[model samples]
Target: MDERIKEFFSWSDLFDYMVTRQLSHIRGNWELTWDHAAQEYEAEEDSYAELINRLVIELSELDPPLKYHDNEDRLAEYCKANLNWNIHKIGARWVGSDYASILEQGGFRDVNAGDLCLAACGRVKAALDRNQLHFDDMEEFHRKMLADVVAIILYHRSDQCITKLS
Candidate 1:
């Protein structure tokens, strides 16, 4: 990875930032009024716990590890509030054949994980430009960041490539 990219990933709060941004979007879409959306997320916290715990465990296992809250309850609550809740599923699906077409066109089949992350970032940007996926609440920078994280997760999960991790 580029030094700058490595620095970006090394930020202790990068995961928090990404999840917070995602939660904001999810909240906005879940309710018409901001206050109501906020309330809804809070109300749903308890119900989201079981799922969040599973996700946290999964996240801990990823290469290029992320920093998570040390307190289990606090971590789970943060995850629920930020809606990092769905990242595991997102990563899993991305690693599957779901984005194969995009990966193929980007010539990413035999690349290293870092290269795959870069390709995924570009494909995500292209998709946004084509309006294939709407992320009305997120900015271009954020979308790319999220794509990079997902691509990293995909790289860890998939065995389609022979590139060894450095």
Candidate 2:
């Protein structure tokens, strides 16, 4: 791993910003929606502990590495420093099979980080809409968000597959 890349991105911070923070917001919304039966929302932290650890470990091992950011301005600075100007074309490897299906199903392939975040939010909405508030469903929701975060970072910083570990 390049020292520069390591200095710029921290998987733990990104996980906290994207997954943990988002889950907190989602739980708040769930509580508001469920009202009297809010306890049914069951978004236990234990549900995502293993998944988050696995994602961070897997990401840390990627070749050429990727990045994560909690700040838009800082991320933009990193992108400007590292990526080609006016050419945001991402490498093919960033889109996994499931993510590909998601883009295709949505009838669009061109995506920005915001789009990916929205897609992840959609997963949560779907789970809640169906009243599938099980821990398994919440875990899946977090998994999708984490995958999208990986895709977003890899889109900017890597052309290698997520499975291409060093």
Candidate 3:
């Protein structure tokens, strides 16, 4: 963690920042390329994949650091107000997956759990509103969404790969 990483109250604030950043990226990119007329047949853009690309850029530059408030509940409320989608799902695929498969469907398959977690966080940015997401309990989409949320929460709470700028 950078000495400058702006400390937190609970895990909630950092998670909120990650969520907001991911969503902003998704919406900006989608608006640039969206074609409502051909939307049904077009390959759905992967917000997670987009987030990976963004992380790559941020990491290389060591630019913006994570920032959050001093309280958890207040931060959570801020997150809810700013969220593009009410909630996203998560599933096992987020923690583990084959590079070939992720590549086939579109994602940086050759990534670690941390990277995968970020990918999940990224999906939240482009997620459908909770009410709009209509997947059966056993549906694969539902499972993946669930995995994304879980991975994100785990990443936010766990201290791994945290580094400081030299």
Residue 142 displacement (Å), model 2: 20
**Once superposed on the true structure, which residue ranges of model 3 sit more than 4 Å away at CA?**
1-113, 129-140, 148-166
Runs in model 2 deviating more than 4 A are 1-17, 24-45, 65-166
Q: Which model, 1 or 2, shows the larger lDDT?
A: 2
Q: CA lDDT of 118 in candidate 2?
A: 37
Put down candidate 1 lDDT per residue, 10-105, tens digits, no spaces.
223233343333333333222111123322122232122122222223333333322211111232233334533422224223332223333323
List clash counts for every candidate, in order: 0, 0, 11
Stretch of 10 with least lDDT, candidate 2: 26-35
User: Model 3 — which ten-residue stretch has the worst lDDT?
Assistant: 2-11
- Of 1 and 3, the candidate ranking higher by TM-score: 1
TM-score of each: 0.24, 0.24, 0.20
For all candidates in order, the CA lDDT equals: 0.33, 0.34, 0.30
List runs of model 1 lying over 4 Å from the truth.
Answer: 16-101, 104-108, 113-153, 156-166
Among residues 3 or more apart in sequence or in different chains, the pairs in candidate 1 whose N, CA or C atoms overlap within 3 Å are none
Q: In candidate 1, residue 14 scores what lDDT?
A: 37
